[model samples]
Target: MSSTQSTAQIAGSGEGGKAFPIPQGMSLSYWLQGVRASPLLDHRTTEQLSKSAEVVIIGSGMTGTLTAYELLTRPNPPKSIVILEAREMCSGATGRNAGHCKPDQYRGFAKYSELFGADQAKKVLEHQFKTWTRVVDYVRKENVACDLWVGDTLDVAMSKEVASQLAAVYNDYKAYGGKVDHINYISDSAEAEKVSRLKGAQALWAWKASTLYPWKLVAHLMKACLAKGLNLHTWTPVTSVSASPSIPAFWDVITPRGTISTPTVVYATNAYTSSVLPSFAKYIQPTAHMCDKVVPPRAYAGSRALQNSYNVRMPGGTSYSINPRSNTDGIILFGGNNPNQALLKAYLDADPNRLFDDSLSNFKPITDAVRDLTSTAFEGWSDDAPAAGIGPEYSWSGILGQSADALPFVGKVPDHPGQWICAGFHGHGMVHIFNCAPGLVTLIQGGTWADTGLPECLELTPERLAKINERANNVGKRVV
Candidate 1:
């Protein structure tokens, strides 16, 4: 789930403002620290744009790259497919995230059951779990050394309120006949603390998750797809899309380089989708997110490092995601809620200010809270520990898309025949993109929603869009 949306609704609907371009030199992401030297960083498929192609995909993040890869590798693939990106490859949320492929096994089951019934809720959870499995399978089968680490993720509660909430969800989901054989819950506070190895652990749940070098994974797949003839153009932003003047049943994707008229266009743009397809302006949203990375002391480093990834919930809706990158440096990625509630209030707001720009200044309190994680949230960090008090100096911000239902909007665009979307992951793209991208391939090949094998709520239907629009209008200026 999106940490920003848990407390407040600042993930403004992609509305109220014109779509802005991502400014250069944004985040110093540990995952992207060495990306500048990679040839794929600025690679363009062609020196000059072709007037036409079989398909055009916007945004070169995971969704876009995977969508193109899936299409190109199909038994009867589309010919001359092109990709358009506004910035460097994989520079979006996929590149800046904490590199988690964790699935929501029980946390959101109750909410989905309440809203869409138990069956759809099960589908949602199952879909994510399957996506995680497929991702791990792909990495293992291909032997991609992107630092893939498959292990359990601890959902630790540090407060009474969160403990009670977790208990309720767990009980409700269990009673509803949801699967729990793969999950382990430590409801006893003492046992939870012992199991999680955290100071204030109240209750905790552990389930399978995978963490890897997300940028490397996306780049590897990008290169593989390029070998199969996918036209990828980085730093070429699609300004807008419209009905082609000369070609019937075709949409012209307008970029600074040129225009491509194709009957099939995929908006895998996530946070930037509304800029090109303005109708999404009312449904999907863009929110600001922050993350930091630091080298850990020997106590939490090397072969003795934490084997489990984590989601630590503090009091008053403050939470943090801790992922020990055992695959690379012993650096732990710390991310989540801005501890200062006052800053969110002051956030370009007091209203629903947009957060599409990736360069938005990060809240210092976020860095401060994460830096002190070793002492404040953990167990057994001595004063004599190696290099204590050295906090993370590499804190950066990225943009995440938030949907009305905290799920993605996938399928054909409303009333727009050829255009399709596979975006609005709510900061949970890693779990959704694998299946969503393949499902998109099914749809592009003239398959029905049922053929796509995705959850019912994920379908981007006219009714769902209108319902979300109504909710946004009811909230008035601030669209959550």
Candidate 2:
């Protein structure tokens, strides 16, 4: 039997699979939609490698699976490669996002320029641009059956404090000679509201983003890798890794049942990366990310579905990324700042929901807040038969790593030979992993620490790590 059971839910609905009475669409995932439309590829349960391979990668989310896929398809493939996952593909944060893909280097450009320098910030943007192109190309070439739409994005500001920030960012990018081709500032709330389908006081629009089905993306990538003969095993978690300067490098990848040893290991576990690299335990911290499904009630069927993704800064001091999904009426992916780790104790203590139902009291606040916001902001939305009218189809929480500098660490573990890491995308994995993984394959093959045009700040060093630790101290806060 497989070690990890498959779990899924309609968006926003609690366990029991009932539709939320909200205005957003259904809560089912696009991946699940695809599976329902077709067939799922076969996979392995926990399996042991009779002997060590040239490389062993842990975690099969976007980062791990993509890394494996890239390595195997490279001009010079590793002698042998193995990928192990703690759960099914896209079972983690990789499957939970809004699928907004963008080379949105601007998101972190201003922050990095302030902390690092203009050169470093520029390099980061350049790197993300490369990654974005690679992602688009891969999705097209691989013929991934996901809804991939390309266009601009909007940053809707519900309050003046946020509008000013949006304006400042827009001007700063322009001053830096950064392209804001699709970015425009609208001072009139009426226009902004109409464009974003959001009730905002003002809005900043940018033209370089796309939205797709995240679960479909993950499944397609996984299928592509499988077709390429990549070896993969699910439910095999790497609990600990042992390495030393004196001893030859070897990784002891632990699973629920057994352990596998390999010469080369890649930690693509993201939020759970610290579990393998204890040295980085203090540097890489896992923070909770959440997404909600909001359905539009039938009364507002006249409103067109949002074409682009949006970031609305709510009056309650939270920012949510809203998009229209293939299944969900509307999806809101939100990030919380400096959230208390203990706040989710109850949910963590219970059994994960197998079906969708919205009966839990503890889960009320988040969906309630989203419902209230949608009711006020969305044009002419009405509550349907569901209690909330656009009730919760499903709401879920996953872990993502925060980098001190808000960039991914995508190279060898410094001073530790034969080990590599590619984690800490900070909710920007799709924006960076395609380019990052290929570059990582080059470094591993060339056996050099050559900078691959990614931000040098991603390098794990005494100084870089120290900065990350300091940032973690203010956990739940956005580093950028």
Candidate 3:
């Protein structure tokens, strides 16, 4: 497809609001700036679908590409592998995120500990950090040109209540024997503000993190996989999959073009996984998140640029994930949801169909709220509007898969011996997929979850699925 046609298709995909018309000149993401012009942007190995493959993977985002990379690099690789994508390469959440690879060193420890005990909770955090480091090491070893940068990430608490809560969580984490050597906490408001470079900061927790151009990294991986005899078919949405009646032990992956029979099938579709696999309909929900790119004025540019990425916590559960791109002229990638009850209600009550559909339209209320929040929340943010205007230069929403149990479901699909799944990252795919993908490849190669070396909780066993179903059902009832 031509650039104009591609943009138009994406615009109609509902990355913006569907009920409202998209504002004129409202760009999606700065990451997609020169993507259409790149040769790897919409690559397809064959216009016609392959009749059969040894393994068939759905979705061409980071998870699918990485899974393919792992499978192809194995000692005894699959003879034939095919990747099917609904949209352009890496055009999903992987390409639309705010470029943060931060691990939850302590913030989520309390909650995870409460749910799964201290040991499992610590393993979760450890896995996240391991994934971050692995990605950094992979980038270096492969010489991937994705502008990857490792640095500290600030978790700034803007209110006294939040600060106190953070302190309590930190205490709990430490009490549970979670690692704290890498984390530096600042409690005094004065020092917090100075350290975070944000006004009204009551506390700050700094830890190791990294940022990168996600699309570029995934593209490089896709290129490597393609060179290793992987068949990539873009713009081909898999409508359904079923056991092949004629071919015993083989499954048929049905797409718009044709069906590809394979013995093994992996669903890396994430948010859209439920659409194809009805079993995950209740387990994995699609949640929309907004993100934007901002061109900083004189105050935030040049030497004054932010050195660390941030997760600024405001009052009433409001928070923003920020990443400053020095290579892109100090452009700040900012993203979050409004904490207001009304906005949350609107999103929660929105039609599931409209929410899952990918289309771009004007979301003025959200856009205005985010702009106001960013303008007032930051310490030295000036009212001076750059060429792009007072608000973000580009703003758009992307769907993320939220699991019912607040954890990803990785490994084989239950009851389907050859079918497998590696999705439901719950908005933390970048920190989880790198580790999850290799582990999934291990399972696909007849290795046990223990061999993959991932945490046991991540395994998609029958018990886990039953537990999720029980919780979901009980949520509708109450004790009176």
Candidate 4:
């Protein structure tokens, strides 16, 4: 389990309400030194276009920023380009991610390969590999310091059932000519401890995983796009799009601030896509994405600490990741729909923190539960200080679209020509978008979706849109 804090009790970022307790050994100098850097994306008055551009993109996060950069720097650039954001650039999911910019080495392509086909799986793999390399290269070349890190991730299995399940899938990945070099399934508690630093654990290690500070990275990219002369605006929420066969080459996009007429439009609003279109609403579902930051004791951040990312399969149906930031201190960022379901009910009920008080009591049992389950294997781990207790520094939620068949619904909106979309990345936007955005740009400019090089499954279809709408409508308790 986990702690349940009432919305009121959950730590807020203000003065004299409830002081945040700074952890022991946490000096002002150290805190200042540890703060990550982000790129500049000015959030001020909304920008007005002297004239509508040839192409207008919505959202200013990675997806939109990356695509804008590609378009402006292409062999033949668009006549004019504009990026409209509802808030500061990178303020959405792009800034809120764990900043782990690694390929999809852990989420085995076996199941996806089986369901889609070997060729499609290979394409997905290629897309992620290229994206990973591009991100690292951009960060390095631009001299962006967002705590870029490179390390393998351990998918720890606490039970035989999980071990068996992973073993079979690991072999399947190998059979499909995929990368499995760093994956090590360990049954010995001693061996697992060496890699995970968590006692009483068994795990499968995926070697190519990495992490970074997401907000800073996105901000840097946004800044670079501006340096390239692309027009960008903030706090401009698009209300709707009027595109029909009669106006195939143009769309009248309405916003709270004003209206813009553009020949082409691209959407980078992943979770909030449905908010603009009633049909899209049935596709993307907004759910609570919860994670907590903690200052583990110095011993935990030392050389003997958990070397890489750790995803633990513990009691109940919950999955947790033990991630070590550059410094010794680490944070636990993991969850699935299962645990969230129970937490959501309790959270919706009358002030669970006052009633059940699980946040530090029953709910937060997992904090110590993992240690007790392993007998100090995660030794040195301690409860968060009042300053950075279980509460997130900036916790918020965004919607992500899910295809009925569990693939991305990319490309043009059928029946609405000249209007393109690049949302619905499931939960793997980092892995999917770096290349997907560039490819979509090409398709939008050249007027051929075939040039995207993605599988047909990723393309929009009537059946896919129907299912997307169905899921978008029934997203109640299951979402959180």
Candidate 5:
């Protein structure tokens, strides 16, 4: 449940908008800070390519790492599988995001029902729950040192009007036969405020959710894959991918280094897919987003800290997704909401190349907005909290692939065979990528959609792509 006015309500950069198609070179996030082992991360498994590989994967983000892991660990895996990254390993959305494995259980079901029917809405929501479960299970099974914490998330409504709006959606989802067994709602205002520890909490919704060190999780799996005969190249930007004229039914993946001919090409490149596959320029619109890592003030620091995660909601559909770490530092991961909505609106709609660059958020008003998170949103926050620059010590931006339909574009590419994609996850990649990657691998292995165990609506087809365009044109905006 992430909110960005620029992402939710805007027009796509369009198919012709490919001026700034690739990712920027330098980017560092809160999660990406202090990472060790530069050799394993940016090491060239083989200096020179083998001319061809059974599989070539683009983007070394969550989708890329998970897909490689699934393929390598499974029986009868591909002989040569290569992963190409535009920048450092896992330096994309997966590395920068506020790590929340919470799914949109009921909030977006109504909107989803309108887009892809109620059945798909239910399946999509269910898939997120399963994905979250998989992440938790994977961390425990692998004994990952990624600071995994299994807990509940509090969806706190700041006003009674918002509370009523949420109640209507909850009722709507339940009426449509969406699962409600795992959810618990607090309707009483006093009880809601007490449970959420927010001053003006009018209502509260609680369910199983978690947060973790996202960069650590990806890097951990990446190390395991390297040991399992995976060839990974970091900072290798793939300029383009074209059909092999000499070898029919083969793709020539052209990089600055060299071209690798392969029968299979998987695009894990979420926001930057348009760089290699121009057809996806309009379908997967890249949008720049911001997040912060804050050292909490005295009131919310140490023993008197925020216990659970929260989606502090306000009117006008804007929100702040807060992750109160269950660690010694108790550093809060704060994200969502843009202070300069008008500026972002113009940037997203007008400039194509600028949106793909996540190095800097053009909106400077975000600094003041992020610093005011605790004081403005939470209860018992000090007025004179540690003078100046203490709040929001580190704030960075990452580019997210905003899908035309709000759902991710998974499975095979529409018109191109042997070319698969699993991207455009909005900000819900943490909950969706765990499952979507394996499903994509299933399709790549000559299996049907049913064999992948994914929702039908998630499949990438010409029909769906056409519908995305139709909606953007008909509705005058791609957001809903």
Candidate 6:
């Protein structure tokens, strides 16, 4: 079948059994609606696919596009680079995420300290903070029109229990000699409520962070890569990848179009990594997450708008990340997973690949809970009918690659010499991918791990894999 015919069939194929279909009710983000529909270099390539390239990068999201950009910009670039996308460019999690680039200032530090050591935990924080800065610098230097905004992000604790836990985590981070200059703590409940504007806020932690149009950034990078001779194929999904039968030391990338034989294959597939690399099936499990855009009333518009982004933490471990869009009439983008049992069970039990198959049936309970939460949870939100008819305008779900150990797997695939991986972001790709992509490029060029300068915890080694599996097994036993 021709590529066009194959793509048509794939689009019509309902759920397509394990193949990752873009979730139903997948509303386009405020960012994606602005970009042109056509991909940068997709149409220029021929339909026939039995091609050969020096490097074949799978998935054209941020990681894949950034990796290609780095490779093409480096001195003595690779002879051939091909990027294949399962759907439209940047339509996956990258396009669907909340667009906040805030790093975990203290919460993750405490967790990482428990998982690894204090030293490694500190490195993780430093790595994330540095990556945030790198993204800021890159966007400014490149003049990318991604509506990048640098501002403070508030982590507001609405309950005493959460407040105490955050205080303990903050103490733990500082006790380990972690940097605290950039973080501001608000322990006074009154002060937190005043600053965060959240009713019943018990405490808050504030730090410098950013928000941006992620789809725009990825599209800009892909365009630059295309200008520098990067071949891109969209609407092309890889069925499987295996060792080349004819060529030694090469792998055959099987797609509906055909096969691409290359010595090096980079899996930037993130949540879909398990579909391509079965070895990581258990390690990098796909979890579905939902986000929505809320059109606020006049109370949140223009000069009365919220000045900073937020991670609002309520009681019962419920939290939501919010970003205010000034250009969109002060509309707020809210995203989070409801802590309710039904919602959690639905998310945990559903197949990541088919979560989008029938979003209404699969996610109605969660989305309804989200709407109710938004209407009642916030400090100034009103559930009563609004004069402006303002409320949640759109709701959508996307898949997040949650690793067993809560850390991304970056570097060479274990036991697979010619294959490399840059997946498993644990739903925090924005803060991690910027630096990780560059580091992965260094590895692809045969550089040492030390040379990449990434956190040691992120290295994808056999030892780390075994430890993650053991941890998962132990947790499973406890649950049983």
Off by over 4 Å in 6: 1-27, 36-38, 41-44, 327-329, 340-344, 347-364, 369-374, 377-379, 383-385, 477-480
* Location of the lowest summed lDDT over 10 successive residues in candidate 4: 21-30
**Candidate 5 TM-score versus the reference:** 0.93
Please give the clash total of every predicted structure, in order.
Answer: 0, 37, 8, 19, 1, 2
Question: How does model 3 score by TM-score?
Answer: 0.91
TM-score of each: 0.92, 0.80, 0.91, 0.77, 0.93, 0.91
List lDDT for all candidates, in order.
0.80, 0.62, 0.78, 0.59, 0.81, 0.78
User: Which stretches of model 4 miss by more than 4 angstroms?
Assistant: 1-51, 244-248, 315-317, 327-341, 345-377, 382-403, 447-450, 463-480
Highest-scoring model, TM-score:
5
> Using alpha carbons, what is the TM-score of model 1?
0.92
Model 5 lDDT, residue 354, Cα = 53
Q: In candidate 6, what are the lDDT values of residues 393-415, reduced to their tens digit?
A: 66655677777778898999987
Model 5: worst 10 consecutive residues (lDDT sum): 1-10
lDDT of 6 at 418: 83
Give lDDT tens digits, candidate 1, residues 1-480: 112321111221245654344444455577778677999988987888778999999888899999999898888999789988877888888988988999999988877776568889989999999999999999999998789998889999998799999889888888878898899988899999888888878999998898999999999999999999988888787777989999999999887678889999999988767778777775667777778776666567666678789998877877788888876676788876646534643663533433654554456666667756677766655444455444464666677787767789899887889988999998899999999999988998989889988999999888877776676577664333
For residues 1-480, could you state the per-residue lDDT of candidate 5 as single tens digits? 122222211222345653443544545677777576556557678887658899999989899999999999998999989999877898988988888889888988888889999899899999999999999999999999998988889888888899999999999999878898888999999999888878778998999899998988998889999999999988777887889987889999887788899999999988877777778877887777777777777778778888899887777777888887966468888876644444665755675555766665425566566656567666767655466645677566788888889889988787788999999998789989999999998888789989989999999988898898888888877763
The C-alpha stretches of model 5 lying farther than 4 A from their native spots are 1-15, 21-23, 338-342, 345-351, 361-363, 383-389
Q: Which has the greatest lDDT?
A: 5
Cα lDDT, model 2, residue 140: 85
Instruction: Judge candidate 6 against the unseen true structure and give its global Cα lDDT, from 0 to 1.
Output: 0.78
